[model samples]
Target chain A: MDPANRPLSPHLQIYRPQITSVLSIVHRISGAGLGLGSLVLAYWLISVAAGPEPFDFAQHLVGSPGGILLLIGWTFGLLFHFCNGIRHLFWDAGYGYELSTTYVSGWVVIVVSVALTVGIWLSVLIAKGTP
Target chain B: MSGRTSLRRVRDLGTARDGVHHWWVQRLTAVALVPLSIWFVTSIILLAGSDHARVTAWISNPIVAVFLMLTLIAMFYHLKLGLQVVIEDYIHAKPTKVACLLLNNFGNTVLALSCIFSVLKVAV
Candidate 1:
């Protein structure tokens, strides 16, 4: 047993929450979620190439209840990941180094991601004549 | 340059000692995604009511195929790095954290392979 391996530091719960920390966590969460969700995309692409029966099956899946939930979740994940990724880019650019800017961007990511998700679903509703 | 430094710049960041590799990659992917993602979304939109041949032909273009692969690959790689950090930060149990990290990488690899193969199969 090595000394370096012994006695680790306390985990995230111990740290007081902040905008940077929250977004950092959500960024990864949404990223992983979206990454997993890409399976649906792969299936759709392959089915598209395989022709109509396969494509129809894929469409049915997307139209199904569970599928719709997953689709909605994936959409939200994509929106959040995209928004947070942009905020991170600004941080990388060193423009949001200021704490106030950091907090503002964090809230912006949350609000905008939600907005984009609803806006998308709204369009879908309108297209379906359900709105 | 001195043997040590302070207030590290973006290009200089990495996992080691306040570095910026993750930061840079995230930014690079963000910039790359702007056009690539738009292209992707638009393709999907155009794909609405698209026939099988249309979808196949669209992706078969070498440029589109290459760029699409790049987009997915970058996305998964970026995701792996992001989740690795998340695991490191959040998981308190050493073995559990390591296991999760391994799972994360493995999952990404499998997904990437499936997606890439599916695209290539269509193209070829």
Candidate 2:
């Protein structure tokens, strides 16, 4: 049999989206976002090491409205990836393979990640308000 | 570094023997990040809107610096592994795929080093 001529597996576009499929793709999307977010984190640290001027520049960048929006987005991505990564870990441990369980856990990941993101942002808002 | 195409290499070798090692390390880093990232997020929340001196002081603490570096390392390692899988799964052209793979490795290493160095410079 010619390997080149072998039929390719169906791609993602062919499938009707389900909770399982949707969350699986999101896990990848959020991961990519966090990878970009890490760059911001790296710059924040580098600016600090560079001294006050650079640090202030970075702080201003992050504290600006656009920067704050980006941070909020990254916050949700971080929490979503964090929660969903735990789900992957559990599956790695040879547990939670049942279809019903996967669905339930998928919902749990979504809800928990959203809640955490909101909580963290609210804390940041409250913190800013106080001092 | 071999000249063989990725499809050819993958088909002939089956699992390539190191697949499990990659999977294992990915999981290890994920586990480490679980606590490390939580500590980081919580600390960031606590330090939100803090002044330069306050933020630097937090990073200057030896304990905080240690954890920060640890988190940076684990996060980048895990990210590299995850992105590798994504690229392999989606990118079909051999040269483009290989280029992306190299970028994934080198990019993660550079970022990780920069962040680690920043932590050390402030802490020490």
Candidate 3:
């Protein structure tokens, strides 16, 4: 094959958005978010290890408005990635190939993930009177 | 240049035949992370309002420490693999791509090790 003249795959912008395609892109996006968010996890763990003052500072930071929003975003990203990842595992196992099943599963992933995210936040809010 | 064929020139540059290993490991880590992430998210949520002493004591538990370390390893490995794919997909420039890939690798290793060490320090 000629390297310079090789045909390119359709660029993302060229295609109309569909459930499968949208979710596919979301998987990558959320994966990237969670990957970066792992640093926050590291920060929390290290703060706890560092002891009370640092831990209190960490808590205060996390409790702040910006930090809370970021945490919510990460929470959704984690849940979406988790649910969609299971869908991917099913596809890898040679299931969920039919178009109808793919669409259904895609919606299911979204609804379930959102529900779980809301559930988690509500639980947090009710327990602590804040999120 | 005189005697070597075009195929010979592009041989190793094309496929390294190591993609399957990368793909397989990504899936393996994904599987491992399913339970690990669930355990972690749920634990953090439950620990939400707890003070520093409670949280530290929780991490210091033998079982909790082991799980935390495992979670860190699998989570970092999965993140590294995923980021490598994203970088390869979008970053076309060779030098920048190489630099990002290297940073992805070394940075992930440092992050994972430090997190693990933190857990150990607290647990002990």
Candidate 4:
């Protein structure tokens, strides 16, 4: 039997998308998003150190509507990855393996991430006196 | 030991020997990021709309500089580890996989250095 010709496992279409599976995939996606987002963050930091002109330019770009949208999306990605990562830590510790607990923890991660994102944004807007 | 031939032993034991170390470091970085990220996000929000001088001054604080440096290092390294796993899992072609992994490592190091350098510029 040729190793290169071996049949692969079942494709994603074969399995129903459960919360556990969906969250699992989203974790990886969010992690990747954060990876890219880190570059943006680094650029911002570098610009700040460079001086007012570059800092203002970077600020202007991020303050724009599209940039704000991307920032918001990245915020969600950060929170999701953060929350789900804690869940993963629990699993790493050999807990949360039961079927019911797994589903509960998945939902908990989603809810907590959403709540935290909203809370942070609300506070930010309020602090800016625009909320 | 079971009576396995030398060829069998060599075949079974592939080239990967440090996978557990990778996993451990990934987890260690993750735990470190939890606190660092909280501080980072809160600081960013608070510093929003502030002038460059104010932001620079904030980063100049000794505690702030130390935390920022730590965050930058951990965040980029974690990002590299996470992306490496992602690329390894999804990329099937051998040549492409090696290329992506190399790029991942190199790109992360550059980004990390750039950020850390920026921090030091302000802090010092």
lDDT of 1 by residue, A59-84 (tens): 77777778878877988888888887
Q: Identify the superior model by DockQ, candidate 1 or candidate 4.
A: 4
Q: What are the root-mean-square deviations of the candidates from the true structure over C-alphas?
A: 5.5, 5.1, 5.8, 4.3
Listed for every candidate in order, the interface RMSD values in angstroms are 2.6, 0.9, 0.7, 0.7
Q: On residues B48-76, what C-alpha lDDT tens digit does candidate 2 reach at each position?
A: 77778998899999999999999999999
Pick by lDDT: 3 or 4, better one: 3
- Evaluate chain B of model 3: give its TM-score: 0.87
Task: Report how far residue B118 has shifted in candidate 2, in Å.
Answer: 0.7
Better of 2 and 3 by TM-score: 3
- In terms of docking quality, model 4 is medium
Per-residue lDDT of candidate 3, residues B24-96 (tens digit): 8888999999999999998999898789999988998999999999999999999999999999999999999
State which candidate, 1 or 4, has the greater TM-score. Answer: 4
**Which 10-residue window in model 3 chain B sums to the lowest lDDT?**
B1-10
Tens-place lDDT per residue, model 4, A1-131, is 89999988987999889999999999999999888888899899999989999999999988877887888899999999999999999999999999999999999999999999889878877778641
Task: DockQ for candidate 1, please give it.
Answer: 0.39
Q: Ten residues in a row with the worst lDDT in model 2 chain B? A: B1-10
* Residue A81 local lDDT, model 1: 83
lDDT of 3 by residue, A1-131 (tens): 88999988997778889999999999999999998799998898889888899999999999998999999999999999999999999998899999999999999999999999999998788878964
**Best of the two (1, 2) by TM-score:** 2
Model 2, A8-108: lDDT tens per residue? 88877887899999999999999999999989999999998889889998988898889999999999999999999999998988999999999999999
User: Candidate 3, B106: how far from true, in Å?
Assistant: 0.7
**lDDT preference between candidates 1 and 3, better one:** 3
Candidate 3 runs further than 4 Å off: A1-10, B1-14
